[model samples]
Target: MISLPLFSLLTDVAVLAQHGPSDVLITGLTLDSREAGPGIAFCALRGTATDGHKFIEIAVGQGLAAVICEEFPATMNPATAYVLVKDSAEALAHMASAFHGHPSRQLQLVGITGTNGKTTCVTLLHKLLRELGYHAGLLSTVQNQIDEEVIPATHTTPDAIRLNALLARMVAAGCTHACMEVSSHAVAQHRVTGLRFVGGVFTNLTHDHLDYHGTFDNYLKAKKGFFDALPKTAFAITNADDKRGPVMLQNTAARRETYSLRGAATFRARLIANEVHGLHLEIDGREILFRLIGVFNAYNLLAVYGAAVLLGEDPMEVLTILSGLTTAPGRFEPVVSEKQRVTGIIDYAHTPDALENVLQTLHEIRQPSQQIITVVGCGGNRDAAKRPIMANLAARLSNKVILTADNPRFEDPLEILAQMQAGVTAPDAAKVQTVADRREAIRTAVALAGPDDIVLVVGKGHENYQEIRGVKAPFDDKLILTEIFAELNK
Candidate 1:
């Protein structure tokens, strides 16, 4: 889609020599050899499972004009052009930026990083920005959007090449600002390298992703990379209430702004009341109302407000925009039915902290006579340490806990449930029931709930597929909940 001077713009000379420059043109850029084309440039990035070096020959034979790789092959054709670098991934990021004309530098880029709340904060910020009349591009765990076009995203943070390409498209589409969820894996992999961020937001860090990073300390270090890479003019907005928030502030060089629901912060939320509809709070001494339930959401709102203010938006205007927003897909999304008076909320709370927060929030809002019921499960082959923790919180906070399967990738669902059940110390372990089928589990939980009771379907928020032994089956909690609601109403 973008035309550039092929001969003059090609940085990897080894690629140019073999291909011969004839009206030099690169139609597209890709890292995977399978996706490469005659005119495309293949970036040979080294990954954990496979080395891109092994695929360089395939890329070259497929008519790729150049190969950007970390090391050059001795058997490589002298005519083939190769750009060798210490880190091919980082080089790919820079090349992608160059190829895209550095689109991020032209727009106001807001990046949010943390163990939790990254998706919620980015989604809320995108909505708030659009409501304020700014054409905003959003990239998160749920989806990627530029203007009206929606692209399915496989990772929370996309590769640098794709990221830069998306930003360029957003700019061409007349977008002025962009919000992105910066995941720890992306940071560790340097997928976001060579991009300039205008503002950085930190939600909170908790135990997760230990499989990839190996330890909590490593995870924290990977997350800190984003703040360390921010531009000098960037503003750092942090959740002062989180124990790790202050540590992030100490690590960043950017101008710092803090928000919290506890103690002192640049922007603070004081909860006046909590109800089924949402929360009533005073933000920075100003009365603001939100339709999002739970104290945790109040913290999320405060972070958004702090980031918006740092971007020069009015405080009251931010509140007004947020008031019109109801719920993010899969994130505490409520499903209502006239016949079934029970309240159903779908949330993406897989980790112990997230599960605890959601359950505790719902517990706080439950009527004295009403019971709290939760359906939750852990993803197979992930951080198994969190399984018992999540179970403990679920049993402790709710009257009933339905243990079900969630992304049982190559692992037995019953085995996963047993691990989680190990943490429930309650005498009423009978309250915990195991259902490997997620849909059936949800149905059973909802069916057991009374009109006054609250049912929470946790994990897999905004996700549409359920992974079982490496195959993704079509499944969505929201769609199922909508169908159940319609049936109950009818």
Candidate 2:
């Protein structure tokens, strides 16, 4: 329903050469050739799987009004308009924003980015804003929201066309604030090209997504790119504890601020007590207790508090609402059995740093008599270098370890387990077990546990399906653990 003149969409795009009429009205924008039609402009994007340029002719044949590409077709269509740009993805983003009436400009958008804790930070901010009596929208890995209406999310950061559309819908729904997670992939692919963010938050960065980036430097660059793009009028809040955290703000023009538990920062907190129940902290000289657990969450809470205060909310009110707030789903969630007194923790700690953080937290607070039994796995077709590292860490930290399948997409699950087993040392090898089936693995971990022992089902937190050979079969770690506990009671 949003239509715009083709020339109007090229606001900041650098056109190498353009042909045909620039005044054609474009009603829709898409990169897929199959989605092209009358009044639609098709953007030819280069991707890992395939290039959109190959299907340009097919889109033109489907009656596309405009074609945006890096190169013009060998045989140009006389009726269709042609736009030659350096990057079609970036061009499409700006065009999509223009077509949607620049909805981001109408709302106070905040983007949180880092290897870990992005989901929790943004989710907390969204919920915190709502608790403060403001209509807020959320775009996160778990889901997208227009105030109370939930929309299923397919990607951590939606592509340009859909991203703008979501913002437009939020604007229409009378949302005054929007908080979203900005993935490194989004910055690399230019998915967030034309949006305006009032603030940006940086949680710590760790080893993640190396399979796509190919190097640690490349991955770091991608994360820093988000901060680099932030405008001078915006605020950049970072974790001073992370060594790389200060580096993220080096080139940023935004007002730089920091939050930390260890060193001096713009906002500071000290961990008074960390227990299985919750956390007690002295934040900025005020003593308060938080419902979320672990040291990582302490950092997360500080970042959330810093961003909220920077946004002009009263400090005491933010802390009041934050004390009762819970963590995002599948993040260190606990399920306990009453009869045996065994505890099961479901988490999404897929990376080496995250897994270590959780294990360390458990070790810090666990009773001396309790044994930590861990069940974990690595996904197929991802960074293979981390497979053994994860297995070794699990074996080193837990009393018992089970390596199982975690989304072996298009790869043999047994082979993936083999790679993981390669990391166990000789002394620790005896305590490690390899189970290719994730369900059976969880069952085995629970069965092996005694009274007061802890069982950790990690790697695929908040996911309800197991992806195998491109098929997502029904599977839920929390549900399975609960069922096992119920059967134990019977």
Candidate 3:
């Protein structure tokens, strides 16, 4: 569908290869050989666990016009064009953008980065933009959308070729705006290198991805890359309430806009009223009511409003659109039983900060004599340091806590529960029970909730699959809750 000439898009053929110049017209770009087609250029990227270089020959044999590899092959065929690059991943992003005629430049692109709230903020912006008469697209952990059709997402941030392809699709579909969640891993790995973001948002940063980056400083640097690459015309939206927000503001080349729920902010949310059903707040001196609960979501809404304002939308208009916005899948998503006396919530609060924020928000709206019970677990092979912290927060906040397995990939589920148990030192430790099966955990948590009690199922929010070892099994928190709720009513 893209009509750009392939020869014109090759910026560094010599860097990618030491071979001769060929008159091959590349029609597409890809990193995986399985996805490569005729006339496509293949990028051989070396990932942490898998090397794409191993598939160079297979790609070339499968009718690829050119192969971009980290190093030139000693036995490459003379007929096949080879380009050598120092870093194939970065080169792929740059070349893919060029090949797609730089579709990101044609649209108003916004990139939001943080440990949490990125998906929620991006989804909110997408909804607001559509209500404001702009055709909007979104790419996030939950799903991918271009106008009306929704596509399943394979990664938090997709690979370069697929990313450009998606952008081209959006452009073709007449999308005037798009919002994307820029993960720290995606930024560090050059996943979004060539795309020009019109606005960048930093929600907040916490201790996460220590296993991948090795240190907190490295993680911060990776997140800073999003704003550092922004153009001068772009706006950097930051959370002034976060301790690291000031530091992040200092690192950007783009203009700055700050939003916060606490402390002084350019766009501040003054809580007018809080209830279990929704929240009422005064944003930027304007009283606005929203259907989203929790103080954390108030921050998320502020960020969404700030970015919407940067795009030239009216504050009240944005608020009106958000006031009608429903909860994202599994993010503080509420479930009701037949009698509708008990309300259940499912959220992706795996970290200590996320858990504390969600629980505190529930406590604020809870009725007198009502209790809050929680079900949560820590993922295996991730930052094990946060397990005890999350447990301590849950123990201190909730009336009851249930520990269970959350994607215990290649690690014993019991070991993760043991680490969490260390932090829960209450005499009512008996209130906290360990369930290795997530489904059973959810059923137990829901069954224990009284008519006035609110139950929360945390971690693995919108995800429909449970990863164990290397396979992903079918599982969805929302689906499970709906089924259980139906049975309870019967």
Candidate 4:
């Protein structure tokens, strides 16, 4: 119902050329031609998969209000408006912001970006804000939220129109702050172009998304672009422990600060103990035990604490609330079979570095006699370069490994297992098994485990469905694991 004259929506948009009427009343905006209508303007975005220019004629024929594109068609409709720009994506971003009345500026929005820990860090920050008696919104890989109301999320970061609309809803619902996860794909595609942030947090960079970015360097640049765009009034907090952490702040205009466990930093924490139950740390000269586990979470906690303080909250109050906070779902979530005493940990460690971190953390904390059995796989149509690396790490770190299918969308599952099998050496090959069925793989790992042994299920942690050949089927990992435990151990 947020109708605006096309001329008003073009306020901050870069216009290279214009034709036809600018007074067309636009009620909705979309990139998809199927959604085009009489009062909607179709933004002809050139995406990696498909070009929106191909459907401009169809959109216009269906009575679109206007066409925003990089290039005009051979034939122009006298009844429709046309605006040409350097980048349609960027234009759409600003237009969407204008349509939504620039809601990001109304709240203290914070964005967290990196290869890992983005979900956990932002989720924690949103929870911390609510604990401090502020209404907040969350945009993350897991879900979007306005205080306690949950909105199912389809992407790590949504497209421009949806992004601003969500923020607008938050502002209207009395939200004072918002925490969002900024993915590399979202930044490179101009999905987050027009949002204003009060602060930005960098988790860490690693080898992932090579298929989309084509190289590690491009991936790093995408992550850095988020901070580079931050205004001087905002704050940029990064992990000092990561070698590439400081690189994020070099060109950023925002106030630069750091947090680390291994070195001195603007905000530092000393890890006193790390157990399966929780982590004990000395943060700002105060020792407190946190509910989240692993060194990765220790860094996430530090990032959240730093952001809250930069937002003008008390350090002691932030620490007090952070101590009882748990991690995001499927992040090292533990499921135990009391009958057999077997422990199962489900995590979303899809990359080489993340898997190694989890395995290393388990190694340091598990009982000496406890054997780690790992079941992991790579998703189809992703960075296949990491398949071998994932298998290699699991084989080297765990007592046993199982390569299984993970969302084989239009790809052969067996072929994915073969690629993973290539990573195991002859010595380690003997301990590895390939199970094409994921549920069976988890069942087998559990049945093979001795009492008190640890079974790790990685890759698709919090997801509730399995995508195969363009079809998504209900498949919750935690639900399946619990059911298998009951049937086998009972």
Q: Which one is best on lDDT? A: 4
**Per-residue lDDT of 118 in model 3:** 87
Clashing pairs in 4: none
Per-residue lDDT of model 2, residues 370-429, tens digit only: 999999999989988999999999999999999999999988899999999999999899
lDDT of 1 at 109: 94
Candidate 1 residue runs with Cα over 4 Å from true position? 1-25, 488-490
Alpha-carbon local distance difference test for all models: 0.84, 0.93, 0.86, 0.95
Q: Distance from true position, residue 353, model 2, in Å? A: 0.4
338-439 per-residue lDDT for model 1 (tens digits): 677878889999888898889888878877998888899999988899998898888888889899999989899999999999988857587888787888
State the displacement of the C-alpha of residue 320, model 1, in Å, after optimal TM-score superposition: 2.2
Native-structure RMSD, model 1: 2.7
Q: Worst 10-residue stretch by lDDT in candidate 4?
A: 481-490
TM-score, predicted candidate 2 vs. hidden true structure? 0.99
How many collisions between residues are there in candidate 4?
0
Our tally of clashes for model 3 stands at 6
Of the two candidates 1 and 2, the one with more favorable lDDT, higher being better, is 2
Candidate 4 Cα errors over 4 Å, as ranges: none
Candidate 3 lDDT (Cα, 0 to 1): 0.86
**Which of candidates 2 and 3 is the stronger one according to TM-score?**
2
